[model samples]
Target: METYRGEPAFNLKGLAAMAATLLIWTGFLLSLRSGSQSVLTTTDLALMRFGLPALLFMPLLLLRWPRIRRIRLRHALLLMLGGLPFFYLIALGSHYAPAAHAGALVPGTAPLFVTGLAVVVFGEPLPRQRLVGLGVIVAGVGVLLGSGLVDLASGYWRGHLAFLGASLLWACYTVALRILGIGALEATALLCAGSLAGLLLLLAGGQVDSNLATAGWPLLWPYLLTQGLGAGIVGGFTYGVAIGALGAEKTAALGSITPALAAVAALFLLGEPLSAGGLAGVLTITLGVLLASGLRWPRREVQPAPAREPD
Candidate 1:
């Protein structure tokens, strides 16, 4: 067994957080999927998701405000591509496809996209297994979308493409996260502040409020909880803990279950039916996730540094 400052390496709390991250992601998909069905626009969902949570993170931004000038404006704009852009695009896509599709498309293809980018941009090697996984994923996405292609002129394909775009944004976000090496809270603070700015801009133009008024409070309140509290705050913190404990690769690999989980949730929560192709697509993509994940469970029992009682 591993040790951390002579204590057992098993951190049950961190493990719990990892599981929470998985559940939160699954729920996030469901919430957005369900919420988009309401009168709310993609812009409305984005505002509630980030804007409502702005206060929780805004204080952190103020505390770090003095050092804000040290960061580049260009980098901040790139971060927006990851946060609000990613969220609204998927929310917009969800309006067209079911949560099941968002679950299948977004997380399913993101790593493959990242792997391809890494190979091209950073000279990273594409091992045989990862290459095969990528092929399987391509096939899976084809089968998933294959039936729908016949109706492309009707614009259903646009939603699927939007989800794909969202995945690419996420791949970029993962890349950005690595380059920045910032804390979980710091990244969340920046993303929230940035998204809030965009939301405010839209609000000033009167593009977001009328829809919210018509959507009504009953429908809007739950979305507020799921996007703002659930995904925005809880998902961020738990994923950070999971990454700290399980290593980024393994934790991300474990995210393979998200789509399947989301599919099940959509069935029960939204009564969304899965066609035969959709079912097959889900399994195929899951297989692809396993192959593409580059899974390496840490075997060496290295001693992690002792956990500290904060001063």
Candidate 2:
């Protein structure tokens, strides 16, 4: 496998990891949208989102505590961006907007946010292809948010803004993952543990109430599987693997397809139909992602004729 800085690059394993992350992220959006419609509060959903993974990874986190403690506070906070704060915004957005909007605005705009961060914060040069791709993505996002901007009473605009915020938070997390050079599993453990601790503190302080006890098993089980296990554990780890293998820009760019998948899934499963604007936004964002990811037809590497018998 080709590698950069000890991390795999453009390899099959990373691609597989990204594929898994896509499915899990799609399910995560759907589940969050469903949870919004349920009796569960955003806090309730957040608890489940972080709880199971924290429990499952507690031992691992304990073992790594000494090393984890040495990480700088700012860096640690950045790594935790994918945790509660991110989930809260997503949950809030899901309450107001259909799953399609969340799907479109969050993952779809990630490449723009990530690339901008790279250029501004990391001082990386923006290639012409990536710059053009980002412009396309911005146009797509404008489509998604255009209707919301005019419909203030509907409150969909609030959700759109929250989704954009969540995307930015996720971008921070993605970049931090590359910067910290931590293993995916270890980072997942830390995020879950820290998020759960914060949730528990919130519960203790009466800042948020829990519905886990009253929500009943049927509704809660699906969330436990999708949010707790799938997103909290599986999604986090696979996303990290993707970043490590594909680099942050490529991972986020490829993830742009997530909006379409989630939007379609939401249509079938949740009966959330996409408007014309949503459809246009999804397609434009996807095309831009292909460009931003630099995907191309695989060419057979031509080998030069063997050296002419030392002539």
Q: Output the number of the TM-score-best candidate.
A: 2
Minimum summed lDDT over a 10-residue window in model 1 is located at: 1-10
The digit string of per-residue lDDT tens for model 1 on 32-131 reads 8777666677777777778866779888878877665455666566556878789878888877877777876787677676666566666666678877
For model 2, state the Cα shift of residue 27 in Å.
Answer: 0.8
Each candidate's number of clashing pairs is 0, 0
Steric clash count of candidate 1:
0
- All candidates' TM-scores? 0.81, 0.92
Model 2 Cα lDDT, one tens digit per residue, 1-311: 11123234456778899999999999999998988888988888888888888999999999988888887788899888888899889998898988878877888888888888787777777789988887887777677555665698998988988999999999988888888757898999999999999999999999988887888888888988899999989998999888887888889888988888887798799997777887887788888887788755457799998877754
Query: Which stretches of model 1 miss by more than 4 angstroms?
Result: 1-18, 66-69, 213-217, 240-256, 300-311
TM-score of 1: 0.81
